[model samples]
Target: MAEARRPRAIDLYSGIGGWSLGLRLAGIEVVASYERWGPANETNFKNNHHQAQTVDIRRLSFADLPDGIDIVVGSPPCTQFSFSNRGGNGDLEDGLEDIVTFLGIVDHLKPKVWAMENVPRVAPIITKELESGGRLHAFSHLDVQTHILNLEEFGLPQRRRRCVAGNFDMERLRAYASRLERLTLGDVVVALGQDPVCDPLYGLRIPKAQLVDHDPEPALNPEELRINRANKTAHTVYNAMPFPDRMERAVRTITATCTRVSRESIVIAPPETPDCVRRLTIRERASLQGFPITFQFYGATYAQKLRMVGNAVPPAFTYLMGHVFQGTDAEALPPLASHAEHLTAPAPPAVLTPPDRPGSVFPPTRSFRFAIQSLQLKSGVRFELRNRFADGQTEWSVDFYFGTSKNIIALQMDHALRTRLVMAIPARLRREVETALAGVSTYVEAADIENMQRVWTHKGVGGTRPFMLLDELDQAGKGLVEVLQSEPEVSRAVVDAAITARFGDDRPAVGLAKLGRNAPVIAAGLLIGSAANGALRTHHLRTTGRSPKTKSH
Candidate 1:
C-alpha cells in the first residue's frame, strides 16, 4: 500500500498561529506563514517552531509564498471590514483591494483546498466575488458545495462567531460537524488551574473579598462614587457566578475593551462576589479564546498580549474545520474520554460574601433602552422601556433626578413603559434630599410628590423644558436606542451605504464630512451592509460606477 500524503498548508496574515495551530493539530503541515505584526510574528515563531516572513499581504506576490501548497488558510485583517471601523469608512475600499489581491492569489495558485475565516459579515462579500470569478467551482471542485461554518457550533468556550468559506468538500465538513465538541468558561478556567488568572486583581489564586465588617449600603453624594459602589456590588455576584448553560455551547467574543472600565456593557458571570470589577487576566482570556495552555505569548505589555489573543483564530475551532477540509471523520477516532472528563469537575468555591444592603442604586438589566435625543423642541433625558409583560404590552415612563439630591426633579410619561432612570448629581446637595426622604419608602414616586407640592403651592408651571446639560446622556441614550431598534439587515445597509459614500465616491469631501459628524452611523451601516447583499453590490458599483438602468450596447 502507498503511504498517505501529509497535506501542505500556508497561512497568510497568520497572527500568533491560531489557524495554523488548529491545522497542525489535525496533522496538516504549515510550511510557511506570512504576517505583518512583529509581536505576533515573534510569538508564532516561538510556539510553532516555524519561521514567519514579516510582510504586508498587499505588497507580497504569489511567487513569494511557498510553491505547491495543497491548502491555504487565512483571516485577513478585519478592522477595515469590521463593524468597529466607522462602518468600514475609508477601510472598505482598502479591504476590497486586499480581498481582490487575496483572491487573485487564490485564482493563480489554485490550491486543492483553501479556507478563509472572518467575521460573519464578510461572507456575503466573499460569496459574491467567488461566484462572479467562477473560482468557486475550481476551488470546491463542484458548483453547489460552498461551505460556511460557524465557530459556535463547534463548541469553543468564547462566543467568537466567524464565517468560514472554502473549496473544501461538503461530506468532510459534515463528518467534522457530527463530532463537534462544546466547552465553557469553567471548563477552560478549571483545566488551566487557579494560579494564572485572566484578571490579575481577581482570578483563581487571589482570594475573594471577606464579608466581615463590610458595609453594603451605597454611599451618599458623588454620583460617580455611587456608580462605583453599585458596580462593586454587581461585581460580587458576577465574579462567583457559574457559567450559564448556553455558555457551554459557545463562549462570548472576547472584546478589546477592559471588562472593569464600563458599567453599561460588562459580561456578567452569575453568583455575585465583591471581586468582580477586575478584567479577565491575560491567561484566562487566552484560554477562553481557545489557545492551548502550552502556547505562550511573549509580549512586553498586557495590551500587546491582548491583541495577540484577540487576533488569533480559536485553535480548537480551527482544528475541527481542518479535519473537515481534509475529508476526515473525527468522530470515528477513539474518544479521549479521560481528557474530556477532566474538564467537567467543579472546583472548590472561592471565599466571598454577598452585600446585605442595596450596595448601589442601579441594577444591571438587559431590558433598558437609553437615549439622549437633542430634539428640535423637547430634549431632556429620554429612556425607552424595554421590559416586556406577559401579554406583550410595554410600559413607558420618564423621570428626572436632581444631581446628588436623590429627589425626583420631575417625572413625565403617558403610560407604564419599560425604562429606569439613574441620576448623577453634584455632591453638595445630597444631605437635603436624604433628609426630605428619610421616612419615605424607597419605592414611593418622587415625581408624584413633587407634582403635588407644586399644585398645593398654586404655582402653575408649563411642561418642563429640556435640560441642555444632559447632552452626553442624550447621545449615549439615543445611540443605544438606535442600535436596539435597528433591524440587522437595515443596519447593515446603512453602514454599507455610509462606507460607500465615504470611500467609493469621488467627492472625498462629502465622505469626510459624513465621517466627521457621526462615525458610528457609518460604522453601523457598513457592518449591516457587509452582512447583506448590498455591501458587495455597493462595492461593485463604487469600483465600476455603473447604473443598472443604463443599457449595454
Candidate 2:
C-alpha cells in the first residue's frame, strides 16, 4: 500500500506563522505563508522555515500559489470590524479591500477545503453573504460551517470569542471541542514561572498631590483619579482597563494595540501584591496567547512584537481545529498540560466586580418600536443597534450604537418589501432612484452620532468581535468585477439587458431634472429595482457555472 500523502496547505495573513505552525504540527504541510508585514514575515521565515511572500494578495494569481494545495486558511485583517478600533461596526476602511482580495483568491483557487478565522461579530455578515447566492455563489457547493468559539473554552488563558467559518464538519468538531479541560490565566502563568512579586512602592500610600511624583497611575485621568480615591476604582489601563489575569478565571481579550508606550491595555497585578501591578511582558503576553516559549518573535519595537502575538490565533486552538478538520481521533491526541494541580487562582478584573446601582428602575421615555421608527425617517431608516458600554456592561444607548445593528435598512435589491417598491416606480425614474438610494444609504450609514460620549465609554466598551458586513459587500462587488473583467462580451450582454429592461433605453440623464432633492427616494427605489433584475445575476451564473434552478448548498 502506498503511504498516505501529507495534506498540503497555505496560510494567508500568516502573522508569525501561528496557523501555519499549528497546522504543520498536526501533519498538514503548510507550504507557503503570505504576509505583508516585514517583521512578521521575518519571524515566519525564521521559525517555520518557509519563505514568506510580501506581495499584495489582490494581485496574486492562482499560478503564483503552490500546486496541490488541499487547504487554504486566512485571517484577514480584522481592524475595521473590531469593536476596539472605533466601537464595533465602524467604517470598513482598508479591511474591505482585504476581504475582497481574500474572496477572489478563494474563488480563483477553488481549494478542496478553506477556513476563515475572524472575530465573532463578523459571523453573521460572512454567513449572510455566503448564503446570499450573489457573487459568492461559486462557494455554494461546499458544506460550509460556522463555529462561534471562545478560546478560554479550549483551555487557553485569555477569553476571546471568534468565528471560524469554513467547509468542514463543525458539528463533530464542536462536540470534540466540549471535552477539552479549561485552563485559567493562573495555570499558564505559574507554569511559565511568572511569579508575583511585591512592588517597592507597595508600602507607600502617596497622596493625590504626590501621585505625579510616584507615577504609579500615570495613565489615569483626573476624573479617574477622583473615582479611584473615592470609589476605590482599580488602576485603569486601555479604554477597557483590563483587570489583571486571575488564576481562577480567564483574562479578557489581548489586543494588537498593546504596546510599551501605550501600556494600559494588558495590566497584571501581582497575586502576592495586588497594588504592585505592571504591564505584561512579551513572554507573558505570548503565553497568554498560547505561543510556545520556544517560538521567538523578531521585531524592532515592542509594539510590532505585540502586534504579531495579539493578531495570532492561539496555536493550541489551531492545532486542535486542524486535528478535527483532518478527522484525527480526539482521544488519541496528547493530553494538554493542566497546571491546575499545582497553581492557585489569582484575582480577576474589577469590571467583573458587581455594581452598586440604586435600587430604582426608570420607565422608558420611548418604546423599542418608537425608538426604531424615529430612526426610520425619510433621510434613512435608523435602528437602535445593540452594543457594550465601556465597563463591559451590556447597554442600548441610541447615541452610541447606531451602525452595528443588522436590522438597519440598507437598500437590498432582493428584499421582498423593497422589490415591490422598486416595481411601483416608473421606468423613467428607476435609474435616478438607484443612484439616490446609494447616496442616501451612504449618508445614513455615515451619520454623526448625536452623543459621542454616550457611545465611547471606557468600561462598557470592549475590543471588536469581527463584524464585517461592509467587507462582505466589497468582496461581492470585487467578485462581480472579476466576472465582468474576465469576459467583456458577457459584461456587455448583461449591461445591455439591464439598461433595456429597466429604462427602455431612456438615457440616465433624462430623469435628473425630476430627481433634484428627492434623489434619496429615487435612489432607494432604483436600488431595489436594479437588485431585482440586473447584470449581476448573469455574472453570478457564469461564476458559479450553475443554472438559476440549481440549489446552492
Candidate 3:
C-alpha cells in the first residue's frame, strides 16, 4: 500500500489566514479561506496567494466550498461570549445561532476532521452542542479526536489559553504533542534585525521614535527640575526594576492591556536603539500571537495589524494541532537545528526575602494606613494595610500582594508601631511570587526603615516579601548635575548649583548625565515618575527660599 497524502483544509472565519498559515506550515494544503471582513480578505489573498471570499460565515453553505476538504477549521467571532462584552449580553443568542449554522455546513460537508477554537469559557456550550448534534459519536466514524489546549505549551511568548475542540484520532495527536517546543518572548524578539530591532520572522515593525510631548525637556516646574537632576541618570538604567523569573518554563498570558512598566508586567524589549517605542510592534504582536513572520497583512494602519494579530490563531499552535490530526508524531520529528542557535541562557533561580519588622516598615501607624489606603484607592495594587492592637500596642502591616515585582518598594516605619504584614496571595500564585523574588536584591532604604518596622511587629501577618530597597541602592554611583544642565528645565546656573551642592567641583552628575545626552535624564525621570504615580500630576520639586517658623529641616 502507498502512503497517504497530506489532508486538505478550508479555513472559515479566516481573518488574515492564521489557521491556513499553520496548516500550510504543517504541509497541509489550504484550498480556500472564507472571511467576512474586506481588509482581512484582501490581506489573506495577498499572503496566501489565493483569493479569500468576503462572505459571512453564517450565510456560507457547504456548496460554496470546493470538494475534497479533508479538514475544516475556524475561530468564530467571540465578542458575544467574551466577558468584556457588556455583561456578555445582547446578540448572544444570535451568536449561538451563527455557530449552529456553521456546524450545519460542517455536517453537510462531512469533512474528515473539524476543529473550532474559542475562549475557554465557551467550552460548556460547545460540549453541549456536540452532544446534542451527536458530533461526539460522529468522530468515531472518522477516527477523530478533540481537546482544549493552552497555546503556551507550543512555545508562544504570550499566555493565551484557549479551548480547541476537533475531531481527530487521539493516538495520532499524542505522537506530535510530546515533541512540541516551548516558546518564549526572548526567543521571538532575538530574531528581529540587529539595528531596527523588528522581528522579521513575524513581520513586526518597530515605529521610529517620535519626539512626543512627553520626551525629555525642561521641567514644567522648578521642583521637577530638582527631581529630574537628582534622578537624571536613572533613565538609561534598563531592567533596573525587578522582573519575574526569566527562565520559568511557563509564560503568562499576554492580555490586551499588557505592558512592561513593572516586574510583573511582561514587555517586548527591542534593541537598545534610539528609534524604538517601548511597546511591542504589530509584527511582534503577531509573533507573540503565534503568526509566522512571513504572514503579510494589507491593512494601512497599525490598528489593523493589531486586529489581525489578535483575531488570528497562532500558526505554531495550529500547525501542531494539524500534525496531530494527521497521525504524525510532530514531537518526534527532528528539531530544526537552525533554531537552536537562537536559544539563550536559561532563567536564574528566584530569591526569597523576609518581610519588614513590626512598626519599622512604616513611618507611623497613621502613615502606614495612609499608604495602604492610597494604594487601595489607586486601583492598581488593591492591598489592604491594617493596624492591630495587642497588649496595649498597635501593630501595622501590609495585607496584599502586588502583581508586579518592579512595583515592590521597601517600607519604613517607627519601631513602636510594629505590626505584622499580611499578604492575601492566592494559592495558585504563591509559587510565582516566590520565583520572582529569587536572586533579586530587596533592601530597605534608610528613609523607609521607620515605616517597615511598624508593620512587622504584629502577629497574624506573614507573606513572602523581598527585603531589597531598590531605590536607596547606589547603582553606577554617578551624579546627575551635568545631565540636569542639558535638561530642558534646568538652566546652566541651576545645573551648576546642583553640582556644587552634591560635589564642590567634580560635577559627577553632570559628567555621567552627559554620557547619553541625546537620551536626556530629565525626560527619563519624568517618564519614570509619571509611570510610578500613575499620572503626570507632579513634575517639579520647587521650594521657597525663606524658612518658615514651623519648619524643622
Better of 1 and 3 by lDDT: 1
* Residue ranges of candidate 3 with Cα displaced over 4 Å: 1-6, 87-91, 130-146, 193-251, 254-277, 331-553
lDDT per residue for candidate 1 within 366-391, as digits (tens), equals 23222223211111211221122222
Steric clashes per prediction: 40, 26, 87
Q: Model 1: runs farther than 4 Å from truth?
A: 1-4, 87-90, 130-148, 194-249, 257-259, 262-275, 333-381, 384-553
Clashes of 1: 40
Candidate numbers sorted by lDDT from highest down: 2, 1, 3
Against the reference, the lDDT scores of all candidates come to 0.47, 0.52, 0.46
Weakest ten-residue segment in model 2 by summed lDDT: 197-206
lDDT of 3 by residue, 174-244 (tens): 55545656666656555443434344333334332310111121112322222232222122221222122
Query: Candidate 2, residue 480: CA error in Å?
Result: 65
Residue 275 displacement (Å), model 2: 3.2
* C-alpha TM-score for every candidate: 0.53, 0.53, 0.51
lDDT (Cα, tens digit) per residue for candidate 2, span 253-364: 8787743223235555546456554555555677678765545677665557667888888877777767766887766664333211211112221112111221223222
RMSD to true structure for each model, in Å: 19.3, 21.3, 20.3
